[model samples]
Target: MKRDVTITNPVLQGVFPDPSWMWHNNEAWLVTSSFGQVPGLPIHTSRDLSHWQRRCSAIDEEMARRLFLKYIRTDNHGIFAPTIREFGDAIIIVSTVMEVMVDKALADGADPDEINRLRAANGNFALVSRDDGLTWEGPHWIKGAVGNDPDFFIDADGTTWWTASRPSSSPRWPFQSDIWMRKLDTERWRLEGPERIIWHGAVEGATWAESPHIFLKDGTYYLLAAEAGTERRHAQSVARSDSLNACYYENNSRNPILTHRTLGEGFPVQNVGHSDMLRDDNGDWWGVCLGSRVVEGYSFMGREPFVFPIVWEDGWPVFTPGDALLRRRIIRGQENTRHGYQLGDIASQEGKNETDRDRHIEQINPNDYLMLPTQPQWIWTRVDDFDYEVLFNPTLMHEARIQQNRDVFASITTDSDSSSVVACISNKGTVQEIGRTALHHDEWYSVRLVGRSVRFAQVPAPNCIPNTEHPLLVGKGAAAVESVAAGGWPVINGGLDIPDSSFAYADAAFLSTESAGGYIGCLAGVR
Candidate 1:
């Protein structure tokens, strides 16, 4: 008799992006891109990758002390994508921290070489140690240029090696780049051999590939790299070699192992690539990567993590459309979640009272919240980095729009003082901060969205349009108004409403809707 089953995604929900993993002893350590613009990268751990909890970050104050003494940079300079590997009794990490690119360079133009050099100058690379994988140290460079998409592995003989996109020292031109590798002495953490270029691709129209994660399985070394481009045209490919340091080439058995279309239309966005693969403690395989987001019509460079479940088929890994969420638990556990929905009481009740909570909660309930087919990255925030968590239901919205009749649903929670709950609305990329009368206890808040044209009953609506000259003067200094694309924001009922100071509205599931643009917008802060 035949049997049937279902798969679930986002093994680690909420902002756990660009994931890579390694097993040390009996425990599994997972690392991901800590695009410090929002929150630091979180290292998740699990006896089985299915049930992951964040352990810590690849960068912290103590880590800074161990790597570079008195090292300081805004959240932008610390760390970007990080990968982990265990060598014998020692565990090491390879990281890249690309300084945040500003709008000016993106505005007039950007020379890829200029961008690369500037990004590297502000970048830091290193491998650190921790008796407990919770914290890391060592800013030691591996005798090469600062590279992106770094992943490492070890042979049975305890030989440590590193492979990264554009791993060698050279200015990257259109598509004239390659993935490079080097053998390193485990003790000193330095490169040994002359770096070798393992593979290369086109550099003109759609340029070089990146984010290579290699794993040795079943006598065949499988190499997975981000190919195509990282825009609406992201893709992934697989290659193999008999030896790790030897010549490895694309399998050619299949052109693209995966593509943005293969994943299906999810979350009304595009641009998905840059992945890292890993094996769970239970011997299951997974891949995590980043994706660009489209909301309404505008685009955002979101660092989303996608998990791809792996199974060997005819000597290659194959995945189902559902198993292709960019992120999916290899297996599900029967462990009952103790965290229940406490914010449900006020969900439908529209009032002046503010709702807040730090943990993620779905609108309505688990039954009403539809988890998207594509797995989504999840993160837990403290009062410091992100202070609020929110949920909203567009289905519940009932309002009139100036142009169109559309409502966006999502949930929100925040950590703020007991005096007020900050609420806001984004009009043409400009955010108006308003406040509500009530503040949630334990730093949590909730908002039930009734309609796109609707406003919170307590706080009145503000003019939706922005003022003249893009002059949004903050404090005493005059700052140019950061323009948000009006063409991309989802069309909704008109006018701006500041019911409360700030609130967050997120899709309950990965790829919540086919909104034809960015998924949602949120905010959390102390008032």
Candidate 2:
């Protein structure tokens, strides 16, 4: 098979993490964890693995709210990693709804019983779609797999299997876990046979041996999983057995088949684990995993999707060129080739009079105002979809000239006095609020910022200084000079009040990379 000379590293950008893929009807369909964001489980489709387009969300807000009410206002509490597979004519998505105990819940006086109840609520679910993934039916709850990152597999003989990470009965550490597998009774939508602890971590006392996925090749069962937690040390491990119900499985000689953890903070892609593999139409093995692009030891965009080629050696799948920093351009096998334009062509195009005329025309406008469009370049905190209209752009970088001009402006209106539109800049790493102001409700307002000065106006009226003594611009360093803004409820008295309704109109020219500090620059949008 031939390979493309270069492929982009992150096939899908932004906070799409814990990727799962399934090939159906001669095309690839992928899904990722939403983590309490509404419209849970976004699905994307691609003919070639290199290019992808979002098809539709597998679960919507109404469905998600009905299924996981405990996730409301909870950070990192909702749809964990999902595994997509084709069982006969139906496509099945097995996933977990995680509502784990956290410091915030403890600080708010949550008892052990309440935490246990939340844990009990966290279980695996199966959603089936028949019409080539256009619509889904029945998030039919699966009882036995009581853990996070569930993987569903169907054997060649038509027997269904389910696997997940469960709290270790004899744990070595506080939250030690092991991967378990069981036969699924599809007719009843539950596990039928006894649960078996198939494989643990590569090391005896390894932690977080989760994200289990099972595959069969040439009569050998390949069980793949992620272990060592999802931080700088995150990695993917594998095990294999001759029989599906083998008493013990053999760990791969090369245990951590894929990871960039040891490459250090200098490598752009960090936290590389939680992967899923697929065989392309051309019979070539390919895999997709989650990795974060860090800058100066900070990653603001969260975990993004990365793709790599896989090769089988000695009956075991090896991530080709095992230990190296994932590059921005990846090369893969392909057939057809189209090499047309080069740098010189781009220079010639730029020299054209029409190009200069177009540039001059756009400059005459001076300001570029944009409303929330159908497909905007916005990366949400966790959830993919939002209820209100929000214009978000998260691609600003230090090299990008967002601070060419000193003046920034915004027009906004709110439904409640407590609700306010905020415009400010801060570092992505700390998300520190630099230049910002709260707008009054029920009136059209405009926010203007010129250097260190910030002003607000109720349209028709002259701009006035804010009555509140709180400084909108408070941070230090480059973050202090750069500006990004969000319009919603302000943090009042140390906590935020969720408003009923709020709206903000923005101009992108004023939102700069300098204001939005952090590793991946600042995210400018409305909350």
Candidate 3:
């Protein structure tokens, strides 16, 4: 038999957290939480679990409008983790609307009881789709599920069951909770039977027993959950019982079935947990979870989706057997599988700045731009910088081109009378002003730097739709300079002293690791 080789970890990348997966018609469909980000609850489809593509957003415009009108604002307040399921011909998604007060409010003496009361008003709601997730209807309130991270389990007898992490009646700590379950009367949209506490984590002092997903395997009911919160100590634990209503559950002998908590700061991947499990077409068990990619203990990409294999031993699920730390790579049935879109591919197609040299580019487009949630490639100077919001709206397009051992060009348009400078900064605290533009409200402009010459131009808006147009110049530069150094440090009062234009000659060496002096490389954008 020919073996199939596949890499099965990190099935999806970049800020896709709290993953929930369901296998349907030989295809795997996955959904993740989109906290405070409109077009929320992103859905992805995969065939072999290694390669995936975003299909459509479950939270539609009408849903977003309703949420905005009811919740007041979006920012850690909208949708939490979502559980996706296919029952007969209907697809159901259960997600929590988190409207709790911010931590700053609590620190500033906000009453916990009042915060809880406001949060209680926000509960789990279900959206049903009859056409294989193309269209959805009815966010019917699941009144019984009082907390976040709600998941659904349809029993073998065709009875619908609901399980969620219910907040503790009395205060202990944030996310100190227990798993609860109750049978649902789908017609009435209410709990049919008595609600019961399922499991309160295997570890004695585990604070959060959340993201509970129940699965039935070989006549056993298994409950898998994430514990120790979503930080460095995040982990996956499993418990098995003979019956759904079993008064007690037996914790897996090899508890914390999956985790990277012990990997320390050296590992590139950390905070591994908040998982959901599924069996593939090959009958091999696999898991999808969230983990962060960190560089020297700093992670800006947020939690991402990763997949791992599960092996059963002694009637228990064992994750990545004999290894406590999750590896960056894993081998599956070898069909010669490749996963994820390469940076080169995304740059070539989405960037519109194609060149022969190895270059990575980020273009500002309406589809990919949002006000509340920051884009992935952007690294802001401060948390409160809302400049991109003003620029991205009204469908203004911008492009940044970074060619290795070459020059960097950035083109931006603004609808505000704000003056901003885009520059190339080195790791050794050196700043080279690439382009500067005086952007008036509702104007289009281009900034270019080649060799030692720098020019700024007010151009016509490119006659192209967002995400489809190539970077093209519309007009000539009004101000041209033979030597950029004559600009006198370009916004010297703003920050970083460049002194002279000699720095532009050394553009090739600007972003090198030796010059940057860090585990990560250099960054270029609006500052």
Best by TM-score: 3
Candidate 1 regions exceeding 4 Å error are 1-7, 25-27, 37-39, 64-77, 100-124, 167-176, 201-206, 262-270, 280-282, 291-301, 320-523
Can you write out model 1's per-residue Cα lDDT over 1-527, one digit (the tens) per residue?
11112223335433444667766666568776544322244566765444566675656544433332122233223355677877555567777655344344445454455444434433435556656565566556555444677777777666777777753245355455577788766566556777777766422233557777777787888777777655556767777787888765646466466665553433333556666665654555555555533333223223345444555677776542333433222223322311110111221221111122222332222111111111112221211111122221122221111100012222222224455444444343343444344543322223323222222222222222112211111001111111222211122111123243433332212212223233222211111
Instruction: Name the better of 2 and 3 by lDDT.
Output: 3
For TM-score, candidate 1 versus 3, the one ahead is 3
- TM-score quality measure for candidate 1: 0.58
Clashes of each: 59, 20, 5
TM-score of every candidate relative to the true structure: 0.58, 0.66, 0.67
Poorest 10 consecutive residues by lDDT, candidate 3:
381-390
Q: Write the per-residue lDDT of candidate 3 for residues 30-85, one digit (tens) a residue.
A: 99887655567778988776678778777766775443423323233567878998
- Provide the overall lDDT of each model, using Cα atoms, as 2-decimal numbers: 0.44, 0.55, 0.57
Q: Model 1: number of clashes?
A: 59
Candidate 2, 288-325: lDDT as tens digits: 88876543344434577787777788988877343333
- Which stretches of candidate 3 lie above 4 Å from their native place? 1-5, 69-74, 100-121, 170-175, 335-357, 362-527
What RMSD does each model have against the real structure? 13.8, 12.4, 11.8
